[model samples]
Target chain A: MDTAGATRILAVVTPDSGLVGPGGAPVFMAHSQEEQERLALLLARIMGGVPHDLENGVYIVVKHS
Target chain B: MQNHVLTILLGVVAGTLARLVMLRSDYRHYPSYPHGFVTHISLGFIAALVGAVAVPALAKPDYVAATFLILAAQQFREIRNMERETLARIEQTKLVQRGSDYIEGIAGVFEARNYLVIITALATSGANHLWGWPVALGVAVISLVISHLLMQGECVGDIADVVPGKVHFDRSLLMVGDVVIMNVGLPAFREKVLEEGRGVVLKPRDDDARLTLDSIGQRQAILHDISVILGTKIDEKEMEFMPLAKKNADTGEIGIFLLPNEPDLECLVEIIKKVPVIESSKARPLSSYYGRRAAD
Candidate 1:
């Protein structure tokens, strides 16, 4: 009955930085704080991922493992 | 001979009655089924039997009977272990789990209650042997009250102030009052939560309360209690809809957001107030003088 999804750091997206998988699934970087949030929200919807705001310019989207 | 028999009978009946009166299946539902009840009651009867016989056995110089009490104590400890295992197993299937601390607390209570039954029975029998039935009855009543007091523990209201809060969203972020729970990507899910969700703010009264509420286990217990009483909107597959309690780093206030079936704000507040503070999570750093000075 655990409510939390078993999630982990899948990818990290920052304002100026991004990461990529061996499969070339790029973690898209955002230009601004607002853009980061907006992209996070959009990517979350498309990817069915959980968007977590680091409260900085960075946002991480995690998917259920 | 008649006095000896009456003493044991009075003690056993008193002990059994004490166990029955104290046994309650509350929101946590420890003794959930009929079998659970049967197991506890059977154990209570055995505890009473052992307690009732101890005094007479000693008087008869039958030292062997005294060893039975030790054996019963071991049995009760095993009961505690059994309870913990059963609850941990059941917890796996719960939507809002009773954390390990809460489970341990409950198992400990069950074990302690059995010991209390033994004490009540033995004391009642001893009183009967010394001063007859009238004094035994008085002792029984006193034991009942003692057991009642022992069972009563501190509730969330004792430590915090529960007030109704609002569940809202600013863009993708889901905010319970002023606290940001998390960023929601799906507009549809965000819309659904905003439409159906309820929120509560737990304001800690002091440092101790803040520390207690800060425990992840205590927060989970609050969520579990609210979810159990009001019925959660989400099922096992829908983890996104599950209730969450988040603490504001600056204010030390906790915001709880959940999509409940009832959605009655007043009822939710009352349930939060009544949630028992888990014994293991209770912290009293403020009690020591050095802790007070360190706060500066």
Candidate 2:
């Protein structure tokens, strides 16, 4: 299967902070750090790997060659 | 002092009989679990009471004292059995995740300490004739409180370990994923993409297809889509699910990703069997993998 066009997106959602993306996407709700880590890991394993460096509690998508 | 001895002895007998009855009646319900030393302590109290009342020799204060010792010994035996049962259950319900280890450890420590406390209380109660009743009662109450605290600590620690730490998916998650994959993704893939031989891979409005592929790649895309919809993490590194495993696309070598207890693979095979070309290959045994490690 050609996966070259696939993009990786990481979004951290917690109870305190709703959803935060890597690129300063508006936070949806407040969440805890634990919740954020849980969401991030869930996203990463689901996608098989994290494509981009997630910082400030947001998911980043990476394009494959 | 003699009357007090008789009262304490009667309490012991009552407690012991009650314990025996409790164990006999309820042991089956928790065949895999243990009720702990408290049950045995109760039984000791019952047995002492029975000894004091029913046995003529035990009517005297000295005999009452002897009865308490005998009952305490019996309680110790029951406690030992309870520990064995608890350990067996722990082994049976082995946690397969990283953070769950702390839970098992904490449970072990609490159980061991609780047993020690019960034993100490029983010994103290049996050894002292003048103030055995009050001392035994006090010890029992204190021990129960400590046990409760230990249980509370274990619960809090387990929650902490599970909530904030890295999510490690285990067999239960795989089973859940298998259900979701079969129910949602399988039908969607079969009707929209496989049967039609082409379909647009939907992307979130902001995210591009290229970036998705780079992060998760092709094989992983299926997993990602499934996870996105189902909302769970795959933590078991050894776990894998393959939809097709006929032969290597390039070298024609047989691929083996399906492991023991991989129900997802079975579901995929069932789907593939509907296709004429794919069904021609020999079917693999899947049920043989079930409970492969259960005894261990």
Candidate 3:
């Protein structure tokens, strides 16, 4: 893979809707903390990426190809 | 003329024998694919033939035939390209990849082995023409030993010490020693990593070793070798179990974390020690004037 093509954010899951802005990856807004973690992990498995916690209630599924 | 036949035949045998010995001695099961095995052997035979012919052709005063050896060198270069292209293409599908530096080292070794065969063939054949069959046989045996000695490359263990490191979570961050591997979002994922994941810190013996360990490609090679040998727990969709190596900025120690199917920490350490030092990644800081002064 090329230098820039290796890592990509496939999806983002956050409990607070205002925490993350709509950007490169699809953003999924979940209600509760439990739901946010579930959605993040589900999307991570689907996209073959790892769910990384930003520690601010935001989880990003980053694919390190 | 009779001696010429004996010289060429003996040279071919010696050269091909050198190639076979080299292949068998390698620790990594490379050329495991049937096609790759066949191709390497065929190329080795061709390399032997060219090398064997060189001495006889030159002795026979055949100027035209001598120039053919130059053509054979061009052919040898293509073998390096062929090996590199094949490995790079296959790298895409691997969960743990042999990095570009490792690939380049492998390709370069293949090309150098061909040259070794040429030298073995030339030496044996030249000996036969000068002396006789018995002397030629002795030359062949000695040349094979010399070739093996020449190819005895360094391993990671020679320059560093690998010891078990603590795999623990600092909040959401995975820590192997002081190196921060990565962040984990899912609590379940964090639990699995803490339970099953193994960590090892490779401590460099000197500044040169530290510089070598700092190479990203070299670190990737270490991870790939371990993942392949022990069998990774990573599945197609399970990227969380994937292995990683992170460098400690302060001490230049490399902290590696991997979830292996085997889970044998002892065996894992042994495998890490044996990881072939990537030629491109090796640095010689102590040998340089400025580097030596800076070390003081």
Candidate 4:
């Protein structure tokens, strides 16, 4: 209902170890080409959110209303 | 009858002057050419002429004649539509486009200004008829000042704090303050952003300010103004490098990360301050009781 706050981050995944994706908006940091491809496949499976591979070596998953 | 003629002429002169005063081409470069400027001035002159004649026509007991003023007012709305269409068409060619919201706000202002000119002309001319040239001149001065004041509107910095921040990365994510702008996939682009980009944090002073800043249109206006002044690093293919404003979900502070042609942080800050708050995005919750409680 609140359009202003409509965009919510589903997770933040990172390439760094011990870092976790926050449940809501997943942010993925792909460290290697293999990891990047693997993460891309996993992101493709998620139905509720959209994963964007920002050309800057990171993947961000965002959810829309 | 002669006095009526004199009064109508006085109104036309005063109204024409008022219209001429308000018409200008500034940062937006709208009415960019002499032809556009002349067209607006001519329309303004007609609006003023119509407004001035209304009073005299009514006084002569020609109520039917005064109805023409209403018709003239309707034409001003067409002016608004024309401006909106022209700006909308022109916007497509812009590198950093002024979003529809900003364009609408500008079109609305241009339309309203014609009405102001009408009022100024009507009042001055009416005074001239009732009193004399001396009193009408005084009335004209007062109305012009009032018009000038009414024309002044709020800018971004009036309701928020804009301060230059650093454009650095938290790993691969680009950020300004706590707001994560976007994730940069290319290290080279990231390095370029770090080298040339500037960051500014906009902290809203209150609830209304927060809401206003939240409007997408207002943010776009800020970006457009910055691009107009400093030039943007936006290439047609490089959408990632486009200037972006992201809000800190927790703090409500908005951060702008831009790679400008001129990276003078202080000048960037000044330009941000001067950027007009889009009219549609302007919020005034303090005027309402419920909004007041939310502010607290």
Each model's number of backbone clashes? Answer: 1, 47, 0, 20
Q: For all the predictions, what are the DockQ values? A: 0.18, 0.02, 0.75, 0.10
After superposition, the stretches of candidate 4 with alpha carbons farther than 4 Å from their true spots are A1-65
Residue B104 of candidate 3: its Cα lDDT?
96
Please name the candidate that would achieve the greatest TM-score relative to the true structure.
3
Model 3 off-target regions past 4 Å? A1-8, A21-27, B25-29
Let me know the TM-score candidate 1 reaches against the reference structure: 0.85
lDDT (Cα, 0-100) at B86 in candidate 2: 61
Clashing pairs in 1: A1-B94
Query: Which sequence of candidate numbers ranks them by lDDT, best first?
Result: 3, 1, 4, 2
Q: What stretches of model 1 exceed 4 Å from their correct place?
A: A1-6, A9-61
TM-score result, candidate 3: 0.93
Q: Which of candidates 2 and 4 reaches a greater TM-score?
A: 4
Question: What fraction of the true interface does each of the listed models get right, in terms of native contacts kept?
Answer: 0.15, 0.00, 0.79, 0.09
Candidate 3: true interface contacts recovered = 0.79
Cα lDDT tens digits for candidate 4, B94-169: 8788999999998998888889888988998889878887998898888888887888899889989999887888
Candidate 3 positional error at B98, Å: 0.7
For candidate 4, lDDT tens digit of each residue in A5-42? 48665555457635553354445676776776566545
Q: Tens-digit lDDT track for model 1 on B1-296?
A: 78789989998998898899888888767697789999899999888888888878777778887887678667878878989999999999997888898888888989899889999999999999888899999999999889889989999998999998989988767888898886665456787888989999999998889999999999988898889889997665446677889999999999999899998999999999999898899999899898788766
B203-279: candidate 3 lDDT, tens digit per residue: 99999999999998889999989988888988887878779999889999999999999888999899999988899
